[model samples]
Target chain A: METKDIYREIINEHNLHPSHHGEISNPTYEMDGVNPSCGDKIKLQFKVDDSGIIEDAVFSGSGCAVSQASCDIMLDLVIGKSREESERITEAFMRMIKGEASDEELEILEEAEALADIAHMPARVKCAVLGWRTMEKIFKENRQ
Target chain B: MTNIFKNDFEILHDDKYIYFDNAATTQRPKQVINAVSEFYRTINSNPLRGLYKWSVKSTAAYENARSKVAEFIGAEDSSEIIFTRNSTESINLIAHSWGLSNIKEGDNITVTILEHHSNLLPWQMVSRVTGASLTFIECSSDGEISDEEILNKIPSNTKLVSAAEISNVLGVRLPIEKISKRAHEVGAVMVVDGAQSAPHKPVDVKALGADFFVFSGHKVMAPMGIGVLYGKLSLLESMPPFLLGGEMIESVSRYDAVFAPVPEKFEAGTVNAAGAVGLAAAIDYVENIGFDIISQREEKLCRLMIEGIKTIPFTKYFGSRIPETHSGIVTFNIEGCHPHDVSSILDTENICIRAGQHCAQPLHEHLGIPASARASMYFYNDESEVERFLEALKKVRSWLGYGN
Candidate 1:
């Protein structure tokens, strides 16, 4: 029997009261990631400082509870961190969701680590990674 | 098709899962399952290859299945039936083959707002290659297609018109006969995506005057890897081969090649003979009870389903609330819950329904919804399933914490 307990109270709490839910007035970088098959889209908007630190980050769009919560949690993690630190955290979170994270990486992913059980549901892994993948895509494009 | 067909389906007897995703695919009857197994066990040979007994026997089974399909849909000739992978491939074949050759720059391709992406995207590509303009005959908010829109959207430059006989998402039965007549008057060909209609009602391509009709076998009762593209014999003969190689060729040399007749020319490579056999068995199973029984049974279930959905104040039914108009599919959204959450909540009860855009993205955009959940019923489904679905649906909002 498959378990449906993936929607823990923490995920619901984040979905209900998302801190990073709206769009930024003006942003340094913006990109949209969509699970084209399932219709989940998260547009990640970020404002970076001159010191290569992310000043503010927000996501806008509609998606499932998990995706909405994941975006909210993802932006909260990277808001005040340097680009270098945010990249490491996002990498750890992605690894954690994909079931490949080490103890050190899981330690870096505090609230986001709640989705670690999501790796068991292969169909939903994309929902947990939409915001992070969009950030990764924008970083690659900016680097190029 | 029969009232007792639930027993014929192995899943119903062996499992407790309630299947409401019939629009995606139906559970196969024991007959279809056994026919496929019998084909593999007895006539295991590459058809249309060798002149041996096994090859001849397999070839006969494949052609016999074609004949059954042609007869099932009221086609005049068996050769008009071209086996494809699924409805998507069948429509793609028409676009790549017929659309590429006939449509030109400055031509217009007309379709309804309710087409599945399978029916919409191929024409999008055809327009791209041919430089043809595309137009849509908008449906009403309740998903009704009127005659005025048909007359208005299809004009002098309209080269080809395609519409689904029934909308997979909205469950709206389009006036294909009316649209086909307008298309004919304007010297345009009519293509009907019968993916949703063929399985639910009696479909006669000639009576409907469709120049081309496409449907998937899996959606009806057959296995995957089998689809049917029914075209007028003249049109199939006029179009170029969608794929060319192997059995599709009459004779071939290094430099030059000659192609076979209509159906064979379109069907390249070794065909899905076993899948065709399974499809024929599925047709036999559905036809055994006939559309009268199927439609009546499904309509009653749909009415019960709609009535149950109406009890939820948060539920917003996307199409006609009247069950007869739905033709057995119902798509809806709860007030404060995302469709994924609605479906996930239902999944905990082992109730299988479809979620997302249902591959009709343009319709969802027009409806101002990001996605919706769908419960598609079939003749095999009973009234208790609908009651259970309603009971589960009512809990969706509360499960997502909408309850105060």
Candidate 2:
């Protein structure tokens, strides 16, 4: 894939002006994900309501465009999802990043399909999956 | 302009990519590649294990390589050279053998803060296991480690002083001779990590006053899995065997074993005979090119890169501003674009560069940067490549959507 295709308008927009690019106040769950090799770091914050539906999700950190934008886009997709639905979507996003998600899985992934070319760029795969991995870890550790 | 020596390297013959990551590893010349292939085809037997014709030839080739390395590094005796897998294994050998037996509680080990992880971590492990303190010799933001800092930091009870001759990240040369003098006065062994310096310049272990000098073969255009460790004869003889097994032992009974002498005592198991032959060929190739020409070409390329970066806005390079101090490495970052993005953008132009902490996280932490991008040139890299690199680097921010 050409560099332009990977850094498309949507990816650049999300990277430059991410809508959920801040901390959630009084967050119910907070976790930091780090890619040790490249030094990419993300602090994931979430506010899940009493019914286990994620009311709010945001992130703050320093990283490359792919990592930062991937996190912002991921939080946008999972904010209104229930704990179970978010988990399933996180799994699908991971699969999409790896280029293994089926047609139905890709449909469920929404805007995250923009990063499907990450599979061709193996070096940036970790950047594309940093948010989903962190969200998965947050749910796995803080079991409902 | 074309690199006069580029055609000698098969990988660089094609204009596929401009390789500027020589600090990580170098591409082997055809001479070295052919030498390795010749060794494998002619004599593939275990060196020191058999008495047949091919076995003797293999043993001769291995020992000849040892002699070449000793002569190349100006060691007094060939027996002082020990062949290992790489510089990491060589440093680990020192930590495990000499450090475990000699260093004790209340002692301190001094290393420069600019060290690559190979030189730093072994000392940390030694400090932890032996109850010794680990201290660092600090450098300035410009990558200068002053003589006063070295003097004050090495404690009176210091058992060893280890430092890199040239930093892999900053590309600054340390004062190995002065550090060696201080360590000697304090009764400490001076160890120099020559992985960076040996490839770009001439190194004499005796002139540097190093008790132990270690460097990797791959970084110097030799094949991987072969490294040279030069120790003072007296020190190598005194230290115990690092890896215990077949070739290193003179005799092995059910419960008792007498180890071989000097170099062999340290190199256990089957050695990389083909790798040694290839390294010898690489040494010959470097000698043919001569350090005078190598330094001249590298200095010119380094100056071009530093001067070019100055013209580009929002780009700053680490280390001393002087190009001579940087050897051939320039680690920099664009203000608005991340280092990974910069490297990826350069990748679109088929330009190769290094991006990350470079196995020196402590140095990165000290410098207050998370990571950096590095473009390290060798003699084979010409001025045109530097121009190409800088041109691509200038567009990195714009490609990432940062406006002019």
Candidate 3:
């Protein structure tokens, strides 16, 4: 497999200049994502409004382009999404990473479908899912 | 591709790929492979058990392998050598058998930051269990630990000093002889982790004054699941058995048992006789090639790699700048690129390199980085392989969209 298959232009752009790459003020839910195997870490935090809309989502940590870009793109998709909508997208993203999501199911993932190739590269599967897993943990625990 | 010994390894049949993760485990030569199979086909039996012919031959082959290890490392007697699953198990044997019983509260166990987790974590467990303080003897940014550093860190109250002869990540050789001498003066037992050094150079545990020397068979071209631990005869006699079962005991009466002597006492259960035979064959191969020729080739390849990496922009190779100091390992990083990404890019070019903390996270933390990429080499690696690696490494940043 070529490097282009994994590090496409979209990934490079999101990794180089992530929009929601810093912390948010008074986050409602936060979780730390750590890949102990390679030392990639991310602190995922979310700001949710009273009606359960994710107002802001940001992450602060160090990792590779796949991990960093995956987080940035995930936040871009999750922001302005309701708790149920974001949870559906999160499930689709996880399925895509595991190489199990159908095209119709992965439609909600949008740009994150770029990471579908990560399923072939077993080593980076952890990196591609680090942020998503952290977000899943936050949602699973903080459900009202 | 012109490496004279490369043809002996079947894994390198494909010229398009280069293997640079030797510090993790070296590829086994055909000679070692054949010896292991031959042992299984011809002398397959439970060693040191039963009075049958096959059992006798199996016992002799296992004991012969022990003698080969003792001779290879210059141990005074074969009884000093104990076969383990790997260096990690050997080091753990020392920690549980020797460290727990000897080390007490208030005593400090000193080790260098360059130690692999195999050498470090066992001591950490000993400290945690025994109430002993675990201290680190830090190396410089370039992986140098001077005599002054050793003298200052290893005080009179120190009870043990464990260190690796060469750092698996940095590839720089430590002053283990000096450190062992100091440990002796302070009445501390010195344990040398020779997993990296034993494969690359000639080592004399006696001359180094190491009370315990441990190494793995796989890292030296033997099959996995076999390792060697060489301890002083008296020291081995004094420590309790780390594992106890059928082979390690002389007699058992339900609640109480009579443990066997030094080496057998440590070896519990049925041993890996085929793995031992492979290791013995590997030792023969190393001896035939000799360290003089091996060191010269490795140094030449390392210098070529270092000089090539120097020309790459926004790149920094860790450890001493001197090529001779690095046995055959070069760990480096490109600015803004994670080591995991670099390793993936190299994989695209059919090159394999280690991209992690190399089981030495404490050293990575000491170097002020989360992780780094390492390209370690064995004697079979040639200059052509080094050139290919450097060429691929140059494109790593660009492949990740870093501006040239």
- Output the number of the lDDT-best candidate: 3
Which stretches of model 1 miss by more than 4 angstroms? Answer: A1-4, B1-3
Error of 3 at A12 (Å): 2.7
Clashing pairs in 2: none
Better of 2 and 3 by DockQ: 3
* iRMSD values, candidates in order: 1.8, 1.2, 1.1
Q: How do the predictions measure up, each by TM-score?
A: 0.97, 0.98, 0.98
Candidates, DockQ: 0.56, 0.73, 0.76
Better DockQ candidate (1, 3)? 3
Q: Which predicted model would earn the best DockQ? A: 3
lDDT of 1 by residue, B1-404 (tens): 33476888878874468899999999999999999999999988999998999999999999999999999889999999999999999999999999999999999999999999998999999999989999999998788888889999999899999999999998989889999999999999999999999899988999888999999999989999999999999999999999978899889998999999989999899999999999999999888979999999888998898888887878978898578888889999998777877887788898999989999999988877889999999998888788888988887766666653
How do the residues A112-138 of candidate 1 rate in per-residue lDDT, one tens digit apiece? 888888787676788778888888887
How big is the positional error of residue A41 in model 3, measured in Å on the Cα after superposition?
1.8
Give me the runs in candidate 3 sitting further than 4 Å from their true place: none
Rank candidates, DockQ, best first: 3, 2, 1
Query: Candidate 1 has what TM-score?
Result: 0.97
lDDT of 3 by residue, B1-404 (tens): 56678888989978988999999999999999999999989989999987999999999999999999999999999999999999999999999999999999999999999999999999999999999998889899999888788998899899999999999999999999899999999999999999999999999998888899999999999999999999999999999998778799989996999999978998899999999999999999999999998899889999999999999998989999899889999999999999999999899888999997899989999999999999998888888889889888889888888778
Please give the ranking of all candidate structures by TM-score, highest first, separated by commas: 2, 3, 1
Cand 3, B chain, TM: 0.99
